[model samples]
Target: MSKAKKVIFVIVEGPTDEDALSSVLKQIFSSAEVHFHVIHGDITTEDAITANNAKSYVAKRIAAEMKKYAYKESDILQIVHLIDTDGAFIPDNLVKTRTEKGIQYFEDHIETGEVKYIQERNQKKSSVVASLCSTGKMKSSIPYSIYYFSRNMEHVLHNVATELTDDQKVELADAFADRYEENPMDFVAFIESEEVAVPGGYTQTWTFIREGTNSLNRHSNLRILFEQENLKSTD
Candidate 1:
């Protein structure tokens, strides 16, 4: 008899994130089942204003999807939320600096020491993570994990792009076209390397991705879920 495939649900902001994560997770888990659900498209602007709104939005959507599939919470092995920081800061928060490139924003947490650039227009008074954590709804949801991009997905890609030369850029572009088919492991290694300079928080974004799997264990929320579900790489 064959073992059952564990179901993992991922909720993201947009299609790009869905695509990117689908590719990455395909490389990470060989036998488990993974699904991506996008929320921003179906949600109203008013429903997305605060962290509670975002959580409610995601919760409703998750419930609907679950019903559509006739699957209960027990059927899912894990639920992951991925969102962008978007440069939202508290009032009178002056822990940022302006440079020729852009505005560098820093987190108040001394241990994190994260810094990332936020374009003036992209900066806001509230962030997605802040809102989600505000009501403690998402955090309290068991078997759930949350990950964030510093500014946005493009910003994360920019960090990787800046580290490569023209030739390397071309090679990377080609690799992406094929979804890094030739050497996905090397691509993963390059992104997680300390040599890659991801400003605005050192390796904050990379650390989020590399958690668990023995590379970096800074935040192991996702890692713990993977282990609990017994997800493993075919390679």
Candidate 2:
């Protein structure tokens, strides 16, 4: 008889994170042995998004499932979580506390919880990237990945879309430099070198789990993590 497949549970912050990261993982690891199990904590409904309720809505839902399932600590399961370090000035003790709480919440539902957090520190680059998308620049032909632009430049490429006057281009470059207090080249290098939150960092945790548990290495490559199978019901 075929052996029972081991399951790994991964929890992430949102859906966009799921799409960008999960797609790459499935493509790279499907050849490896073992199946992946994923649980999405994203709130896809418009009502949830409009009410600014995704984080809490997803969190509560995950907690409920864990309560219903009697998962134990000895099972070969993995739990991964992504957290943004907003400018809350949260105390170190509180950070530890919340992190432990998150782990326990999963352990209570599934066996063997492995929780990891990717925090944000470089505020300027993050703000610029976020604003570009929210302000509708992405729709006009700006692909979101920083790799698309000059990776070595420090400025924000000033208008990613549309032809600009020479003077306007120079002004935009200067504004980006002034805002970040760094040369465009240096800024680009820093961003590229940093450990970024993967495009679908949260959603692809299941892909990571499947490959990691079956293989000898545990590298969290964005390209490899996004391609895993779609999430399955945690019921």
- The clash numbers for all candidates, in the given order, read 5, 21
lDDT of 2: 0.30
Rate residue 73 of model 1 by lDDT.
Answer: 63
Per-residue accuracy of model 2 over 134-214 as CA lDDT, tens digit each:
331122221112111211111112313333455664565555545444333343343333232223343343233222111
**C-alpha lDDT of residue 166 in model 2:** 53
All candidates: TM-score: 0.56, 0.26
Best candidate, lDDT: 1
Residue-wise lDDT of candidate 1 within 1-235, one digit each (tens)?
A: 2226656778877665565557666556646567788765423123335544666666777889877776666566667776554333322333344334433333331111223322222233244344454442332343655654544444454444122344564454444636654455654554554543232342353343332221111121222323333344421
Given candidate 2, what's the lDDT at residue 73? 30
Candidate 1 Cα lDDT to native: 0.47
Error of 1 at 150 (Å): 1.6
**Best candidate according to TM-score:** 1
For each candidate in the order shown, give its overall lDDT on alpha carbons.
Answer: 0.47, 0.30
Q: Give candidate 1's TM-score.
A: 0.56
Which residue pairs of candidate 1 clash?
A: 51-131, 114-201, 115-200, 115-201, 116-200
